[model samples]
Target: MAFLIKRGSKKYPYITARVRAMKSKLMPREVYPKLMNMDIPEITRLMGESEYKQDVDELAQKYSGLDLLEHALNQNLARTYRKLLRISKDEPNYLITEYLRHWDIWNIKTILRGKYYGAPAQEIMDAVVAAGQLGYRQITSIANMESIEDIKSALANSPYYSAIADYEGGELSTIENELDKIYYSRLLASIGKSKGEKLSLKFIMTEIDLKNLKTLFRTKKAGLDKDVILELLIPGGMELKSRDLKKMSSLSWSDFLKRLEDYSYWSAISEVVSEDMTSLMDVEAVLDKYAIEYASKVSHYYPISILPIYDYMLRKNNEINSIRTIVRGKKVNLPDEIIRKHLVM
Candidate 1:
């Protein structure tokens, strides 16, 4: 709806300038190497001097150790993303807002899972990233709900409500799958009427292709019916078609690999599948890396578009995951090599 403002050829100098400055301030790859070796306090101290200073300082008293690190990271990510939303107005802002809505889907799913597992409200609250369309109060209220049904009711007005409410069973997977579908479906649908926007089209198509490939591999492994797989598939992928997926579904595992050989993701998928890996974790990591790389490239071409903000969001999420992986690995004293393998970077 924000795309109703058609200021074609208008230069968003203010927004683009601000974003460029922020992009320059992101922690460099070299910084990660140094941080990886620092103790918790040292990590905190180092971060205090960076853009994360205010967040780290604000959260320091109440939380220490991993809690402190996580809170600061989440807060910083939220602040950075919210800044982008504030600076961007009109069409660009709308696209960024739509993408950030994924965080709402994320928060909803996290709350539902937490309630289903009977996790304490505080624990659920800690896991949420308040960087989406959902207001802080809404997330807090949802987090405090005692029952999964209450959580569902709280989300009745959310974009996910329609899709999630359609599930007949109380299974958490049903809700989760619906959430995933809604996120992707909305993402594809929000490309606006700007069929000429190359950057936007590329971002959506690449995302769809990555997701479709993941779904195909997982459904094949689970020995699910082709119809069910198709049901799970999001439309509008650049390379994947319903017919291609159907054909792939009928082939033997080896034959399926052969079929995918000519596809763009074939190399990555081939490596994982050939090893007889049952866990889709590695495949997911490969996809994450690829997605990041793709976004980075798009940002280079369309710096003023929503691509950079989305790239930054993806990188921030990856950074948190990478840090968590490192911290947990160090806590358990896993070999650095093993920990490195687990990281998406």
Candidate 2:
């Protein structure tokens, strides 16, 4: 997306105000409790009557049931982010776009998975969001390609190429992890370009920390070697160092929880950890709650800056994810309690 304003321009106040107004229109937190009790058709009908109506209406002709809801959620996410990109200018524009490029990393991973699994090109294409720096043409080109190697070749000139180059012909997981590293590195580098962007940087670092912690817990449970776990850890986390993670990976699960109890995350995580060992999803729930709370705090702390827009984007995405969970759960005829448990809200 092109910037609407040139260098030396400062449009943060206007853009922040607009994003705040948009945030106000988000699906209220109280609505989800009621939605969890609804069936698939009821959920779909509720969505149709809300802000998602346009996307639902547009896709309803070609798709039905959960498939339709899925398509509409994806569409609305891309459309909302696209609007943000369109209205933003200068530093605000650059920072917002940089944050959204995480989806590019996501799209690449999806393509690789599809290629390895021999999924149809259309199926692969349908999974793409096109919300990142890569345009529709580039995403379509990658999705249309027959193999992961071919997708790599198509992206050879981009920075993403470097992430895959060293791991060419390696295990798919290796390549995927490399992409994760590259995405975080680029995120930090972009934050560096914008002076006094502390809140944004903090949020990004918090995300990296959560990701690393999740990986650590998973690897520990899998009984992976400390060296292998260390190798897999991404750098630049605010709380946990690579060395600390290496040690934690080697510790017993109980010991690991003991260590976590000494940190800020303990309050949220302690409830889930026990002798039987908590599920990975439980740990993730704590992290997700902390992240949302952190973003909310940041937005209020810096009302007339890019922080609010970033917060809005995160909240909006969470809402989309919650709705998707409800749709998927209802489609499977899952219990309402089980469906509600999956929602972030």
Candidate 3:
């Protein structure tokens, strides 16, 4: 694996060529306009004839309509991500796999929340994406556990167990925060030595900064104290320091806007604070757009690196999310303008 990874730079021309080919197959912006006019079954049929064909066909027997769409999307994402891992066998593969660990965090949170909400075990299992190191059987077992404590015990042997176990009380917020911290900590830990991997490190750090900023902004909007906000804020952002976040957390809304004025994130932060955008939803929209733009720029400069793969993955995920949003919005009879606003395009 190390040998293959070390040779990746030389092999990069080939790898990047393949990635570009795959990237070109992605649904274009024009497709969405036509898709918006189609019914659910028509949409499924359209997808069946496209890149999602095999997944759609395989899942056709068991699921239909939205369930089918969701399952196909999940399977496609998992398959594509796993293929990336298989192709790039060394450091690049390791870095990509580490990033995919977010799915592990996602799976854990889904199981915990499903248990908390008393969802059916099968339903919880259906919702999980088995793209991480955790096997499907382990996730199924976790889902089958009768109580949250039993689920926590199942996770006890995993890296997230210790952080999650410390929150003995049944506060979902505490458990969730611990999970967030563990995810980000693991991300930084996986970076290891960063001397030659500045592009990868910068991309990951920028993501962390955006995530922390979103969390802090939400906490402030909710009138939560600095300590509470810090509890959820991951510590490894590149540009935003803990002390700076602490200071921002302590400010009044106006003061917070002032503090962010000189920062790179000033424009977005100002929009949220000055416009009194009470909802974190809009703030999150801007963050996603900003992150995508930043990742796109990084990938353009470092095409041979993992940046392109990361950018493609992010964009693909965004595309799936946009589709899901459109389907749900249509189902709810939301105006097209409102739905467009909800989209991250």
Candidate 4:
């Protein structure tokens, strides 16, 4: 259970108003499909007309096609997140800072995965976003490091050190899982007790619940037994308690589906989920859609508080993600319907 430390908030009015102005510029869900039909050059032309125009133009002489777009998008994301830290103060600052550590943890996971698979440093670097506490230079340096032990030594004093300390190049999933648990636990520990805190808490807990649900789907699909699956579940969700997860994990596949119907999330997954289903990909997408919709819906209630700020951040992040998905999907000649299905919004 997460609570908050009491503190007087400052300048949510200014920050909220500013973010509202920025939100107006985000591409709506409808805009993504149109881009799916566009080629890389066409999409680049489209990007040239948006807020990314300057970035696209400035990098045009140096790079073109997908290369140009990817670099521009990464630069914009880093700038946007940095601006959030610069503009907000007090509790909002604390909240945003902690939450953005998600990028650092994500970058770390990408690095570990890359190294484990012997991917080149440049390939690993391409996957990292310098939007968190670690700056571009630091992440670059870590990417170039010789070994996991070397990386661990560099991060020794940081919050994430413990999450990876025990790893001796074992299953990277174990380390990834620990990174997630540590991230949320640290975030909940740092949250403050303001009027807006409960909303933030709800957002975080819902994230945990959804993450656990995705884990549940994957584990069950792989035919993992109850005890193993329970070991994999994260604690501290809004609902779907450990005991509940245990009970569901122990049930027969059909009984597990029956048990899930009692939860609010069941409605979103009902049609796509069944004992005969061979894939949980569609079910997982519904959960992701629910998370996006839930974040946007609850944000309106606390207009001048941290809720809008949080929503704006996620919206901005998701827009670029959708854009990338379309561009990449088209480049690979994936079917239009397949691209649409992969889109989160």
- Judged by lDDT, which candidate is best? 4
Which residue window of length 10 is worst by lDDT in model 1?
Answer: 4-13
lDDT of 4 by residue, 253-278 (tens): 78888889999999888888989998
Ranking by TM-score: 4, 3, 2, 1
Off by over 4 Å in 1: 1-8, 166-170, 195-198, 222-228, 267-281
Q: By TM-score, is 1 or 4 better?
A: 4
TM-score of candidate 2 against the unseen true structure? 0.92
TM-score of model number 1: 0.88
The residue pairs that clash in candidate 3, if any, are none
Alpha carbon deviation, residue 132, candidate 3 (Å): 1.4
* Clash numbers, per candidate: 0, 0, 0, 4
Rank order (by lDDT, best first): 4, 2, 3, 1
**Model 2, 341: alpha-carbon shift in Å?**
1.4
lDDT agreement of model 3 with the native: 0.80
TM-score of each: 0.88, 0.92, 0.92, 0.93
Model 1's lDDT to the true fold? 0.76
Error of 4 at 313 (Å): 1.8
